[model samples]
Target chain A: MDPVFMGQVLVRLLPPLGLTMLVSLTALAIATPLGLALGALRAELSDKHPASRIIDAWVFFVRGTPILIQIFAIYFLLPKLGLQPPLFVMGVGALVLNSAGYQIEIGRAAVQSVPRGQWEAAAALGFDRHATLREFILPQAARRMVGPVMNELSQLIKASSVLSVITLFELHKAAEAISSANLRFSEVIVVEGFLYFVFIFGISLIASALERRLSAAGALAGAGSFAR
Target chain B: MTLLAARGLVKRFGSFTALDGVDLDLNRGERLVICGPSGSGKSTLIRCINRLEEPDAGTVVVEGIPTTDRQALRRKVGMVFQQFNLFPNLTARENIAVAPRKLLGLSRAEADARAEALLARVQLAGHADKLPSGLSGGQQQRVAIARALAMEPVLMLFDEPTSALDPEMIREVLDVMVELGQGGMSMIVVTHEMGFARRAADRIAFMDQGRIVAMAPPQQFFDAPPHPRLVRFLDNILGH
Candidate 1:
């Protein structure tokens, strides 16, 4: 309730903000391209394809489990498998794998949402499948993907809090330390919550701005008539 | 010279036979119109020729080569769809220029120049920068035609190109096709527009139940009519 105390908690939260961003952005940076490739493969390949089946299994497993369990499993289980990565790497790996699963679905849905006529047109124009996907299909799909991708990024940022259990000091862990020490649980929690809001709301703003910019080019205009 | 040949083309969709042991040949500089009732496989035949649909039986040869290399075959053959299928994200000019730029390795300037010329050819010179959505159905179809023509394809396939257009817009697209036909581009058009068939096609073929029942020069096709099915089709379409 006290303005001074809240301001102090906000400053304490600042240092961990960079760590939170680093983990989220790094995971996002690695997961995005990986997810896009998997997503495109999932969308383009038949459900009967072996690769598609594998991707389907991965998506199913990821969606079915909790992020907290995923984080815990990676943290606790990887050492048993003789992979002793640093705590930061472990946290990032978990985030990337977790986000990549969702990203793949997002990518698949976006790519699949493109009208089939576009594919036919690309084929008729003498483009190989790779060129068709890269040139014609992805550009249109990318526009539709912006919102979901940013949403995933926002979720990943918040999810980074789970890394606290793994001893990676991100935003939430920083807040826990401050609140535990000061015993001003309500004040510290409010400031921490506010920080999370500002971060996510900022991303949402960027997302809508991006959506507007992409749509301004008329990519989505008359999209309904894309198929016959 | 024969520009395209399809022999014993058979395509089955599960229990349905879309094309049943069909055969066709098109000479260079020829414009052939194919018309039939719905589900008669006219579109399937053309789609098979371009390798868009693989036939369960038979081979399509173009310029004396079998269509084993699909990308190469498609390079030589262009197709326009009933729906315009213009890339929604690309402007008309980019839509026309993309294939040449990507497939043929044309420079941007070269492709743009070629696209500009095509835009002019299609009577859409000023609309080059407009996206497909900004263009009318007719204009979009025109852009689609220009996009097809940009490949400098030796033969073109039209699958009911104007069937999706408004009544007033149909002629604009048909006019482009007529002009293209006059320019000596070989084409196989599948449409119900008998007037276009009469105007632009050197030969007209009537199909029913997945077979070509009659084929002749437009005058002979309309005047004498070899088959009873053709007679009924003509009467049904032209009787109005």
Candidate 2:
């Protein structure tokens, strides 16, 4: 492997890093809010007087299928139905749906960690469901969700590698393109792996820091009791 | 006018009756102390005052408002939880300011000023900017009291406010309650601290098995203790 060609492979992988993160983050923006709403709604639905099964089907359909296949069905098969979304949109569309599916579990777990007494307290304070959830329930849930959501974001960063398979010019695709042309595929793959590590590691650090800050807010009282 | 009235109060959870046909009344500026054995519904009684627990059968009327109107009732009443229940993501000042600002439409400056004064009253003036994590157990409970008081509530409810604190931290919180009692705030406290009850409670209610077995002036109730269960409970606790 010539160091100079290795340099070219490194340069080729650069553009894709930015592209991959941009695409993954854009997918994340679309996925998170929808996932949060669905997760909160599902929890309320489950606790309803006579429980509904529609949410069950929604969760089942999403968690049961493969995201890669979901993307393939949307990209390769949807064109036959006269729904001709471009490759990038299909890629992001698939990622957002997949992201929302996993994110829903994370969000629901966070919402559950919020003490039920809080909802009662807020309601007792005259806040209706909409105001109580908005002011108290969701803010607490958002703090709790920070850790798992960050985990999801890191997962998205790694999963963006898959976008290369659909002819998207992501980091991994650039590595593949340069390697196949130069026949120095091993070196390019090594470089690509390093980029993935850097991206994921940076995000992991940010996630932990934010978790520390948010959980510290009311920490003293719970801790203070034990400390005394 | 009665500050609080519980009429035929009964609470049940899946056949386990926590409170059954209990009735009680509280007057303005009165301090009531309640004590009982484990699962005796002392906690449930105060909890119902502010709508923390729903009575399976009964009515709780606080300051002319029905506890059934939970939202409106809560704004007029304040609760200090055994666990503190302060928002962990907010500073002491912010925790105190939240409901007043949101519920009462107080400006941030007005709420902050009120919270600061309340914190001072609880001897926690220096701790306003700190998080609950940075405060000691006594300090956190003090902040909880300040948070409750910031609402300018017509009545306050304390559910074992110092139970979660260490022994050394108990006196600090008890002293604050005593001061609040002297200042004419109506309050109901659920506690095992007989000393606090004697010093602060105008009336004492002893509960056993989902009923208020006795209610009287503090001295008479603590001295004579009209029922056998009260006698046994006091003997076991005070004897030790």
lDDT of all the models against the reference? 0.90, 0.81
**Residues A148-192, model 2: lDDT tens digits:** 788888887777778777888888888888888877777888889
Quote each prediction's TM-score.
Answer: 0.95, 0.88
Residues A1-228, model 1: lDDT tens digits: 899999988987998988888888899999988997799889999999999999999899789999999999998899999999998899899998899999999999999999999999999988888878877788788878888898898889889999999889899999999889988899988998898898888878988887887788564442322211
Please give the range of 10 consecutive residues that has the lowest summed lDDT in model 2 chain A.
A219-228
Scored by lDDT, model 1 comes in at 0.90
Identify the leading candidate in terms of lDDT: 1
Quote fnat for model 1.
0.76
Alpha carbon lDDT of residue A196, candidate 1? 86
For residue A173, what is the lDDT in candidate 1? 93
State the lDDT of candidate 1 residue by residue for B108-182, as single tens digits. 899999999999999999998888878999999999999999999999999999999899999999999999999
